[model samples]
Target: MSSRKFSIVSGFFLQDDQVHATPATIGALPPRFGLVDDSPECWSKFKSRIAELNDNASSGTTYKVFFLGRHGQGWHNVAEAKYGTRAWDDYYSKLYGDSEMTWGPDPLLTALGVQQAETARTAWLKEIPNGMPTPQRCFASPLHRALSTWQITFASDESFPQVMRKVMILENLREEHGVHTCDMRDSRSLIERNFPPPTYGFELGFTEEDAVWQADVRETKDHIKGRAQSVLDRIFDDTEETYISITAHGGIINGILAAVGRPSYSLPTGGVLPLVIRGDDV
Candidate 1:
């Protein structure tokens, strides 16, 4: 980790009025103070401070040299609007068999989602073509909305689109699990068939069956934070990239920020935030 070349992939200060982060350049995210990831001394200091900052009854996402993205709008967004978050969380699947909820266990992006992703695609095109770094690697949650958004945001039709070949599906990157019907994913078998091998690679290390999804379980702040930490550790330890992109959900992004002691931020559907891991931080 110490020797890895660190850089950024997009993002702004937590207080920004807007969701999208500015393009990669010095002086981006004006209000953000102190390189969030500095060195080992700073990392220890940050952990102690985060341990204190995390005193609220409810707990926290942060990342470095990473592109954090939320899945675009989904059928679940519409359902939640009609039914509200509480009931939609509690009874949508049982009452409507998921058709009225997020369309199914693994929700797909809506037309609006595709439109939102296209908007994101426009941003990425400008950024990537204008000297911003393209991802050295890419990862997406197995959920349809996430995978779909990944496809739209990163896909290129040029003669050599090798980056597409490099994308991998990371089950750990999926959103908070099992609380809402829309969050429950499709069967692993179906997922594997849909995502396929190294060509459309699903990480081989992922398990065949979901380990979570208990009827009574809802991912707590601690749960999410731990998951965020675990995922970040895996990425930083294993990746060859100085830059990366994660197509996942708002909750996971939130968790990541909090866990890493960075200022908490929000990323709406198709929203993208860029972060850097200064070489000093591990």
Candidate 2:
């Protein structure tokens, strides 16, 4: 990493009545000991020593993350069930009437879902002071449903500023249960026939068939964890005092929690999970 020096105003260092001692009289020091009289070589050596001192001065810095979950009631369960039933064809015909149902994007949240998000915002704001500094960075999934949930939950909150919000179209956080690009145009029968078992039976010698299915889920989860890690790495590497808020799906949030070694943590709809990451702790 390249090293650079920048001046920063340190409020903690300001001289005030709170400080117990008087300022030291550097000008009263012996003339031979003055900082200006030091040679270039000596000054360079002194700077290096100060850098080392600073590094050893204290414990590592800590970063805090807050995760916001989207609302409940997705269409996937109903859609998948319809696909498995004989009523599938008739259901679609009746449901769409003259129009055709589109499968490309996920369905929007229900009215109850919107209420859930609003409830969460109201609950959260009740605890945190409105004047408290908001998170320095906010990230949200690109999907309309997730993005909508984020907007409705935080946009109305007095604590969250619109300028801090940013959307990240992370493919890694996309649902892993659906058909991929390769099977997009395939017939329903063909896709259904290729669907793998829900659970892996390890006693089966890790067969190629089993491997493929396991790889699909594992790779998706791994990618989600990697993306979460990348977000954290960027924030910490910059050494900025940024509190982070990430709005994503349940699966992706689960993956992040698992990556952080909290696999038991489950975030409910519109729930916020706060995490503190410390350099020394990590």
Best prediction by TM-score = 1
Candidate 2 Cα errors over 4 Å, as ranges = 1-61, 77-104, 130-133, 157-159, 162-220, 279-282
| Tens digits of per-residue lDDT for model 2, 1-282 | 222111211121111112331224321111212223234354345335434545553555443434345444334324435465455433431232212223333455556557766765665464334222345655655444555566676665545555444333333334332222111122223322432222101111322221121312234566666655554554456535445666666666666555555443334555554443333224
Candidate 1 lDDT over residue span 146-185, tens digit each: 8888777666434224774357887778888765666777
List the RMSD of every prediction in angstroms. Answer: 9.8, 19.5
Clashes of 2: 0
Model 1 score (lDDT)? 0.63
The TM-scores of all predictions, comma-separated, are 0.73, 0.51
